[model samples]
Target chain A: MPLQNIKVIAFDADDTLWVNETFFRKAEEDFCALLEGYMPKEEANKLLFDMEIGNLPLYGYGIKPFTLSLIEAAIVVSKGTMPIELVQKLIDIGKKMLEAPVELIDGIEITLKELSKKYRLVMATKGDLLDQERKLIKSGLEKYFHHIEIVSDKTEKHYKKLVKHLDIQENEFLMVGNSLKSDILPVLNIGAHAFHIPFHTTWAHEMIYEEINHPNFKSFTKASDLLQIL
Target chain B: MPLQNIKVIAFDADDTLWVNETFFRKAEEDFCALLEGYMPKEEANKLLFDMEIGNLPLYGYGIKPFTLSLIEAAIVVSKGTMPIELVQKLIDIGKKMLEAPVELIDGIEITLKELSKKYRLVMATKGDLLDQERKLIKSGLEKYFHHIEIVSDKTEKHYKKLVKHLDIQENEFLMVGNSLKSDILPVLNIGAHAFHIPFHTTWAHEMIYEEINHPNFKSFTKASDLLQIL
Candidate 1:
């Protein structure tokens, strides 16, 4: 079950191609510190996670929604007495996150460059379109992708749509990414091959508690290993 | 010419199908009020507009980017001494815009319901994916559209890509929307038929000072008028 017949290799942009979840982790730490007076760091972190999950339907995914959730959590944790100063600080935190430099994962460029020569490469990621497009432009990897899809969510249906738009069969598609929740499971469920390249920091929302074993699934420790796997 | 042989009829979401720019206008006024201590409303509006144009490439479009621009403008206008309250107020303004009710333009439902019977209706809008999707879902008119495209920009290249993806000839496509800059000119430039139904309030960025007249173009005062023309 090697990548023998796959004609399209789609890469997930965030943690798989570049460092993403680490910045979020750092932002969460900073958010908790900013609200330490209201609640302990652990409690504050849990409340923020709850707020993010609760607001997912309303805000979808991205730094903006995360920032909004941070504001809402601060107000709730502080019993609506949260000063405007802390709220502004939270907004600044979000701005800094958006402005952060895109640090590509080790060996991503060589991997993509090499893969592009053989298979059609596509970027499939879900986030704020502006932020994601900015990150892609900054990464300087846009030229390698044949197509880029900034979708609302990565469900089985979305993967099917991507394959249909690419005019490729499920067996001809392969997805690679860092998150089992977003990148691997849904793709595998759609009967497409998926490879998981673990990043050190995974967002709480993207964590999967149970191990998934599937015939179309493979795990690699580093992106460079993908060159040999394919 | 009638809409005979038209294979696709696409509508712009923001001002074409529903009320959108008015909310942005309201947000701007609220933002200026929040920063009234630092600058007059007119001056602040100019500066914010300048910042938005400057940050367009980096932030693209949507309430989130607009919110970021508001924050950046406040910091610059206040010379880094802006109070936290103002920043918080800006964030709230953005949230309210996102939360604003989706009020469809008069006769939009009848037009869509009628046009959808004879033509392939699509939603071609430029905005944040989440915000646009939320608005479509809230509009309760999602079922009328055969396809929905939330794109980064509306340009000749974008329209070409859309027509190609939809598997239709440019001459067989018709675009209907409010903005001449975004909806009309680009579509007409790409050799597609376009109809303009003017909205009462147009954003500065969307305003076209020069008149555009093309053989493939027609003007309507209201959405209902499209029923008779097509």
Candidate 2:
């Protein structure tokens, strides 16, 4: 069946807009290389991941300046293998992370420009507040969106707030992104239609979530290809 | 300050008890190299991430024999440049990913050994059922807990079902992992105390969810360090 009633189409900003994971992934590799003298990559990453996960409650998601976490993780993993250079290396990675310009996803602008005409296109992404806004504004894609929802979480509260903020009906909305946990599944749970467009190299964290067994949820292989359903 | 009423502790398997992201991340690096011959690393990754984000509704986590996705992506990124050797290279990377072993986090065995003395200790992880179960069983760490809850997702319904399967109380359960999106956040929502042990180089697909902002949710840098709280 055609997915109609999707009056509000929300897009995830990170991988959906540009690239998010690989940049961080590259920085992490560099971080590990710098720490190779003190600890093996596997040991060092385990420690780093432990610290990052533990600190999520305090730092939230994208608001987290991961450089600090990277430094702290180095110290923890070093276990007194103490080194000053590693901390500096993490700082360098952070600079690279922020200074990196946004790279638009293939066919994203073309699809958005086209979809905006037929639907009330809104950007519903979850990430650090300023960074996401910066990306949207810098890409010049911000103006086309009727509403922009940048949230740390995409729980029911996050979705409900977006619905209210945008004055949208849950049934008339569609959320798209790579994350089943954050995008399709949750949106489907709330009586909204979600068109999942998964990315490659699915994060282990995002990998844990399962597909929704529902009538409303749908999926596509590419952003431009989503036009048929839209 | 003490974690109370906790009888059973469940751990997310993939990167929780063991190291998996590193291999995946490494595989991604190799995959990108293979694709770069046809498309820029940036463009190749953007397309891969985009395609991955699209598959969540269809695949739903556990690094599904993702060779199909990788092959499909390479051809798309090639835009007619895909050569047989490159396809073979991509297959080789996919094979490496499939063969990557689950290396446990340092000190996990020691810590879990201690925790198992006081708690029921279930491995509440999700993945390819056989793969997840195999990783656990082969690790020789499978005998530590009384329960093993392996499934595709861990929503309220999933958690509730697992709890029923294990016959545990709401206040007595704890979920631990590197992703707040999966391991920490959902458990907290369902009236349980979750331990967020963040991992650097977490999977990109993992939803970077917001905090519960509730009192019962919790986190720690080291599993051994959890002793201080208890």
Query: In model 2, what is the error at residue A168, expressed in angstroms?
Result: 2.0
* Clash counts for all predictions: 0, 32
RMSD of each candidate? Answer: 3.5, 19.0
User: For every candidate, how close is chain A to the native chain A in TM-score?
Assistant: 0.97, 0.93
Classified by CAPRI criteria, candidate 1 counts as: acceptable
For residues B1-230, could you state the per-residue lDDT of candidate 1 as single tens digits? 44586999999999898898888888888878877888999999999999999878756788877887787778777766765555667777887888888999999999999989988899998888878878898999998997677677899988998888788999999999999999999999899999999999998988989887788999999999988867
* True lDDT of residue B106, candidate 2: 71
DockQ (0 to 1) for model 2: 0.01
Off by over 4 Å in 1: A1-5, A32-40, A71-89, B1-6, B29-55, B68-93, B164-172
* Interface RMSD over true interface Cα atoms for each candidate: 4.0, 19.7
Worst 10 residues of 1 chain A by lDDT: A79-88
The digit string of per-residue lDDT tens for model 1 on A1-230 reads 55688999999999988998989999999988988998999999999999999878767888878877787788777876665566668877887888999999999999999999999999998887668877898999989987677778999988998888788899899999999988999899999999999999888778998788888998999999999967
Computed on alpha carbons, the lDDT of every model, listed in order, comes to 0.86, 0.69
Candidate number achieving the greatest lDDT relative to the actual structure: 1
In CAPRI terms, model 2 is classed as: incorrect
Evaluate model 2: give its TM-score: 0.49
